[model samples]
Target: MSHEFTVETGLVAFSVGGRAQFGWLDLVTGSFHSEADGQCINDAIVAVEFSSDVVH
Candidate 1:
């Protein structure tokens, strides 16, 4: 299993708070930093391109 990012795989985050956020995701190496303080995310998680959920 490959949890790393490829050429087409990248990360996109939403600003759920009032402040602006930033992240750097390297597609070739599958690396990322999601905060101004330089906090790294879990490297063991799988990167999924598509996700779906339905509610009835």
Candidate 2:
């Protein structure tokens, strides 16, 4: 016997409250920051890109 399964993906909130807002991102702009709490400000932009909605 064999079994198959599928998985779903979704966007998660890395920053809480107004920290969700992302400043204008441009090619020339090598830096970005959250006008709210500045959470993960020094962290890589791609690192905190996804928070993962799924538990697994």
List the candidates' TM-scores in order. Answer: 0.29, 0.24
Give, for candidate 2, the lowest lDDT window spanning 10 residues: 5-14
lDDT of 2 by residue, 1-56 (tens): 29542212222223433334443222244444443453434443341344445555
lDDT of 1 by residue, 1-56 (tens): 66754434233434434333344556666665563665655442433342237422
Off by over 4 Å in 1: 1-21, 43-56
How many Å off is the CA of 2 in candidate 2? Answer: 64
Error of 2 at 24 (Å): 4.2
RMSD (CA, Å), candidate 1 to true, equals 10.4
